[model samples]
Target: MPHTKTSDGVRIAYQVRGDGPPLVLLAGQANDHHWWDDVRDDFSDVRSTVTIDYRGTGESDKPHLPYSVERFADDVVAVLDELAVHRADVYGTSMGGRVAQCLAARHTQRVRALVLGCTSPGGQHGIERSGEVRRSLIQSDPEEARQALLKLMYTPAWLAMHPGPYHTLGDRSMPAHARRGHLVASNGHDAWDALPGIVAPTLVLHGTDDLLNPVANAPLMAARIPGARLQLIQGARHAYFEECRDLASPLVLDFLDQKAPLR
Candidate 1:
C-alpha cells in the first residue's frame, strides 16, 4: 500500500501487482483499487497492473467537496508520478472510463493506450439508461436493489453461480457527502468534446446487453477516438469486464501488445 499527494494536496492510495509492461486500472464510480481484485492476477503474467483509490473512496482522502472527472485523472497522474511511471496503457470501466477520457485527452502524453469498458461520454450525447433501470437503482429495499443491480450488471447465468451480489458492488461505506460528490462527478461528466482529442490507441468495450451505460455508447465513443477499436462481449451485462474477464483480459493484452495506429 502506498499513497501520493495530488497537485491539489489530496492523498491518493494505490497498489501495484505483477511486473511487466505497466497497465493502469482505473475504477468506476465509488469503487477503489479493490475493483481489480477479481482480475488483477489474470493480467499478472504479462503486465504490471496499477490500481488506485480515487479521492473520497477506499483509503484515499475523503474530501467533502465537489469532484470532477478531470480531478480524478489528475489524482491518477499523481500516483503514477510517485511511482515514476510516465506513460502506461490505461483501462477504465464505467465512471473510470470517463476519467480515462479526461486523462488521455487532457494529459495525452501519459497514456500509451486506452481501454474504455461499459462507459459513456456523458452529456446529452451519451445514451441514457432505460426508465426501469434508472428506477431500479433507487429502490429502497436493499435486497431488491441488490437483485436489480445483479440483473443490470451480470447475466442471470453468471449470477446463478456467483451468488455474492454484495461483493460485485464495490465498497459502499464511503461517507454520504463523498457518495454525493461521486454522483455529481460522474453525472456531470461531459467528455463529448474531449473524446476526439484522445490520441492513444483506444479500445472501446461494452456488453451487448449493458443497460446501465447502454451498449450504444460503445460504438459512439469508438468512432470519436481516432483509430479506436470496438469489442462487444457477447451475453455479458454492465460488469462484463468482471463476468467475462477470460475474454477481456486477452483482448486487452493483444491490444497493448500491438502497434496501435492512431490515424
Candidate 2:
C-alpha cells in the first residue's frame, strides 16, 4: 500500500497500475480509489493509472474537521510530488472534477491534459441536484442510501438489464461521517472564475440523464474552459462511465492520445 503525507500531515493511500503515460484518477464524493476499479483496467493497458483515497475516506486520515476543495486539490499535488510526477493526464468525476478544476487552476503546469466527468464548476451558476436526489444521498442507513444512489445513478433500462451490477453498487457502503465530510468539501467548491485559467486541453463528459449533477452543467464548464470538448452519453445517467464504459473508455483514451498543439 503506497502512501504519501500531505503538508498538513494527513496520509493519503494510493495505487499505481499498468504502464504508459501517467493518468491520475480522482473519485467522486464519498468514494475512494475503489470507485475507479471498474474502468481502471481499460486505461491501465495504455496508461499508468494512479488512484488515491482522498482525505477522510478509504485508508486516508479522517480528521473530524471540515474539508474543502482547495485542500483536496493540495492533497492531489502532494501525491504527485511524492510519486515524482511533474505532469500527468488527470481524470476527475463528479466531486473529483471539482478538485481537478482547482488543481488545474492552481497548478497549471502539473496537468498535461484534463477530463471532467459529470461535474460542475460550483457557484451561483452551477446546477445542483433536486431535493429528492439530495435526500437520497444523505440517507442515514447505508443500505437505503445505496439503493437510492443506484436509482439516481443508472437509467431504469440499464438497471433492469444489468441487475448484477446494480445490486453490487447497492451493496457498497461508506462511513457516514466520511460521507458528510466529502459532501462538505464538495459543497464548498467554487471554480467558476478558475475554469478560464486552465490551460491544459480538457474533455468534459456527461450523461444526458444525470439526475445528480444534471447534464446542463457539462456545457457550462466546456464553454468556460478554452478548447474543452463536451461529449454527452445518450440515455445514460450519473454513473455513465461505469454503466457505459464501452462508449466512455474509448472517448477518454482517444482524447488522452491526441497531442496538444504547441502552446
Candidate 3:
C-alpha cells in the first residue's frame, strides 16, 4: 500500500497493481478500494489498476469536516501526483463516478479515457432515488440498513447465487462525523456544467433498474459529455457493474484499449 498527503493534510492511501497503463478505480461514498475487488482482476490483465481509500474510509486519515465532491476529486489528484501518474484511465461507480466527473472536468489533462458507472451529475439535473428506495436505505438499525442495501443493490437471483463482498459494501465502523461527511459530499454533488468540459473519451454505464441512482441520468449524462457513450445493463440494479460485469468488463476494456497509451 502507498500513501500520500493532501494539501489539507489528510493522509490518503492507495494501491497500484498489474503491468500496463494505469487505471484508477474510484469507489462510491463510504466504500474503499475494495469496491472494485471483484472487477479489478478483469482490468489488471490489460491495465495497472490503482485503487484508493477515500479520506473518511479504510486506512486514510478521517478528519471531521465539511466535504464536497470536488474535495474528493482533489484527494484523487493528490494520490495521482504521489504516484507520478501523469495520465490514466478512470472508472468511477456510484459517488465515485461523481468524483470522476470532477477529476475529468477540473483536472482535464490527467484523465485519458473515462467511465462513469451508476452515478449522476447531481443537483437539479440528477434523478434521485425513488422515495420507496430512500425509506429502505434510511433504516435506523445499521444491520437492518445493510440488509436493506443488499436488497437494493443486486437482483434477488444474483444475491441468492453469490455471496460476494456484501459485508464490505459500506463502512459502519467509521466515526459518525466522517460518515456524515460522506453523505453530505454525495448529496451536495453538482457536476452539470462540468460534463461538457471533459476532454477525455468517456463511457457512461448504468443499470436499467438502478434504485440508488436512476438509469435515466445515464443517457442525459452521455448526451451532455462531448462524445460520451452510454451502456445500460438490463435487469440490473445499483451494483450492475458487479452483477453483470461479464458483459460490462469487455465493453469497458474495448473502449479503454482503443486509445494508444500516452508516453
Please, what are the lDDT tens digits per residue for candidate 3 over residues 164-252?
A: 65633677667888889999999999999889999999999999988888899999999999999998899999888888989988989
Worst 10 residues of 2 by lDDT: 165-174
Better of 1 and 3 by TM-score: 3
Stretches of model 3 off by over 4 angstroms after superposition: 165-168
User: What's the TM-score of every candidate structure?
Assistant: 0.96, 0.92, 0.97
List, residue by residue over 45-93, the lDDT tens digit for candidate 2.
9888988888887788887766898999999999989988989989999
| lDDT of model 2 at position 159 | 79
Q: State the lDDT of candidate 1 residue by residue for 97-175, as single tens digits.
A: 9999999999999999999999999999999998999999888998798778878888888888987634447578788
For candidate 3, the per-residue lDDT at 253 reads: 91
For model 3, how big is the CA root-mean-square deviation?
1.2
- The residue pairs found clashing in candidate 2 are none
Prediction RMSDs, each to the true structure: 2.3, 2.6, 1.2
Candidate 3 lDDT (Cα, 0 to 1): 0.89
Mind sharing the TM-score for model 1?
Answer: 0.96
Query: Runs in model 2 with CA error above 4 Å?
Result: 138-142, 164-175, 260-263
Scored by lDDT, the top model is 3
Candidate 1, overall lDDT?
0.88
- Candidate 1 residue-wise lDDT at 194: 87
